[model samples]
Target: MLEPSIDALQEKINSKYTLVTLSAMRARQMSETKNPLVDHPFSHKYVGMALEEILAEKLTIADGQKKDSE
Candidate 1:
């Protein structure tokens, strides 16, 4: 089972494409910066950490195109 289930993530991002894109972009940023929004990320992999951030509501899409997070 996916740790942060798809259903749970869907609540944060309505579109799957947006979700994937956001996750991928965030993951790349995380890999390069080695910094995560969540104090304690559930997964070591950047992608998983990104998903966790989404589930925790620490990350969000603002005004459709903007991305915001702690």
Candidate 2:
């Protein structure tokens, strides 16, 4: 199965820690709200879905916060 690359996702974020934190936070949000940034179905697991969203640039981190956040 195809998977999102950690290297590529890392390039979009500041650091490895930030990427991990962002993905975890996004996965939690997705699991709690059942809302996803990406329209197409990718993965059943929230973490994988979050990673896919991050790789696609649908989700982004800004100032240590999710870009979708105000």
Best candidate, TM-score = 1
For every model shown, the clashing-pair count is 0, 0
Query: Which 10-residue window in model 1 sums to the lowest lDDT?
Result: 61-70
| Candidate 2, 1-70: lDDT as tens digits | 4577767877776477877887899999988899888887568899889888888888877665644223
**Which ranges of candidate 2 are over 4 A from the true structure?**
63-70
Q: What is the TM-score of each candidate against the true structure?
A: 0.85, 0.76
Question: Each prediction's Cα RMSD?
Answer: 4.5, 4.9
Candidate 2 Cα RMSD (Å): 4.9
